[model samples]
Target: MSQMITIELNGQQQPLPPGSTVNDLLAIVGSDGKSVAVLVNDRIIRPESRALHQLQEGNRVELLIFAGGG
Candidate 1:
């Protein structure tokens, strides 16, 4: 079995598999992938690199969502 790691998600601590990537985090957060932005330890993550970004222990992650308004 893989070790589970804890990360802060939207201010709450969440447990994830050791090998989890940004893409996996997106899935956990129920992101539709259209109007969302991701940041890890204050670094902006491009959409194309989300899959390649590997999360580490005690990494600070922030997720932003853009909503359409008139």
Candidate 2:
């Protein structure tokens, strides 16, 4: 079994499996990752890097989603 790690997701505590990447978190959150900006420790994570960027314990993550309205 994989150990879980806690991270701050938009100011709340989010538990994720160890070795989870940005893309993994997106999937877990039911997000398709489109029109969403992800930041880790105040650093912007590019879309191409999301799959390779690994999240660590106690990391601060902020997710901003863009919406279109007529």
> In terms of TM-score, which candidate is strongest?
2
TM-score of 1: 0.85
Off by over 4 Å in 1: 68-70
**What are the clashing pairs of model 1?**
none
Candidate 2: lDDT over CA atoms?
A: 0.93
Q: Which lDDT value does model 1 have at 50?
A: 85
lDDT, each prediction? 0.84, 0.93
Worst 10 residues of 2 by lDDT: 27-36
lDDT, candidate 2, 1-70, per-residue tens: 9789999999999999999999999999887646789999999999999999999999999999867778
Candidate 2's C-alpha runs over 4 A off are: 68-70
In candidate 1, what are the lDDT values of residues 5-69, reduced to their tens digit?
88887677888888789999998878855568888888889898988888887778889886678
lDDT of 2 at 45: 96
